[model samples]
Target: MFRRTFWFTSGVAAGVWATTKVNRKLKQLTPENLAVTAANKAIEAGHRLKDRAVGFALDVRDNMVQREAELGDALGLNAPVADRALPPPRRYAAIENRTGPEHVEGPAHQKNPYNRNEDH
Candidate 1:
C-alpha cells in the first residue's frame, strides 16, 4: 500500500513537471519570441552579405590583375595598360569669339549654313 501511494505521488510530480516544461516552451515559441529570433537571424545574414561583397570585390580585383598579366604575356608587351596617362583637355577660345551671339535673328539652320541637320 505504501509503495502504491509512493508511485502515485511520483507520477503526479512527474506530470506536473512535464506540464510546466511544455507551457514554458510554448510561451517561448510565441509570435513575439519567434519574431525576435527571426530578426536576429536576418541581421546576421546582412552582416554576412556585407563581408561576402567585400571579399568578392577583392577576388575580382585579384583576378583582373592575373588576367592582365596573362594578356601582356600573350601580346609580348612589357608595360601594363594602367601606366599610360591621358592628355589634358585643350582649352578653347572665349565663347563669344568662337560662336556668335546667344540670340540669333533667323532660324538656327539659316544662321549657320554648315549645320549638319539642314534639310536636304
Candidate 2:
C-alpha cells in the first residue's frame, strides 16, 4: 500500500509540472495575441503611407500654383480674365434644307432595341 501511494504521488506531481510548462508555452503562442500584433503593424503601415501620399499631393499642388503665377506674370494681363467671351452665333440660311435617311423595315430588325434577353 505504501509503494502504491508513493507512485501515485509522483505521477500527480509530474502531471502538474507538465501542465504548467504546457500552459506557459501556449500563452506565448496564442492566436489572439498574434492577430493583434499583425493588425497593429498593418494599421501603422497604412498611416505612414497615407501621410506620405498627402504630403506628395500638397507638394504637387504648391508647384502647380507657383507655375501658374509665373505664367500669369509673363502674360501682360493685369489680372486673370474673369470669364472667357463667347463667340458669335453661327448663321443659318433659310433656303438650305437637310434630308435624313429613310427608315427601312426588315424581319431581323423587329426585336426591341432596349430589351435585354436576360429573362429568357
Candidate 3:
C-alpha cells in the first residue's frame, strides 16, 4: 500500500510537470500568437502617432488665428472707418528722402530716386 501511494503521487507530479512543459513549448512555437502580439503593439503605436499629429495640427491652427488677430489689431484693419465720409487717400512720400546710392527714378517722375518703373 505504501509503494502504491508513492507511485501514484509521483505519477501525478510527473504528469503535471509534463503538461506544463508541453504547454510552454507549444506557446513558444506558436507564430500566430507572436504575430498577433506584434500587430497589437503596432496598432497602439500608430494610434499614439495619430494623436500627436492631431494635437500638433490643432496647436498650429490656433497659433495662426491668434497671430492674424494680433496683426489685424496692429494694422487698424479690424473694422471699417466709423464715419460715413470717406477719409482722404493716404499720400506716400517720395523715395528721394533717403538720398542714398540706390536712389532711382519712379514711374510718376516725382523725384523718386528708387526709379521703380511702373510702366512695365
lDDT of each: 0.83, 0.77, 0.83
The 10-residue segment with the lowest total lDDT in model 2: 95-104
* Model 2 lDDT, full chain set: 0.77
Q: Is candidate 2 or candidate 3 better by TM-score?
A: 3
Q: Which pairs, if any, clash in model 1? A: none
| C-alpha lDDT of candidate 3 relative to the true structure | 0.83
1-120, model 3: which lDDT tens digit per residue?
999999999999999999999999899679998898899999999999999999999999999999999998897777667733677999865534556634455764455344555444
Backbone clash count for every predicted candidate, in the order shown: 0, 0, 5
Error of 2 at 14 (Å): 21
Q: Candidate 1 has what TM-score?
A: 0.51
Instruction: Please write out the lDDT profile of model 2 over residues 5-118, one tens digit for every residue.
Output: 999999999999999999988886799978887899999999999999999999999999998888877874446466545669988544322241222346744535553334
Give the candidate order by descending TM-score: 1, 3, 2
Candidate 3 stretches with Cα past 4 Å from truth are 1-29, 80-119
Kindly list the per-residue Cα lDDT of model 1 for residues 1-120, writing each as its tens digit. Answer: 999999999999999999999999998899999999999999999999999999999999999999998998787675666975677999864334435553456565345555443444
Show the lowest summed lDDT stretch of 10 residues, model 3.
Answer: 111-120
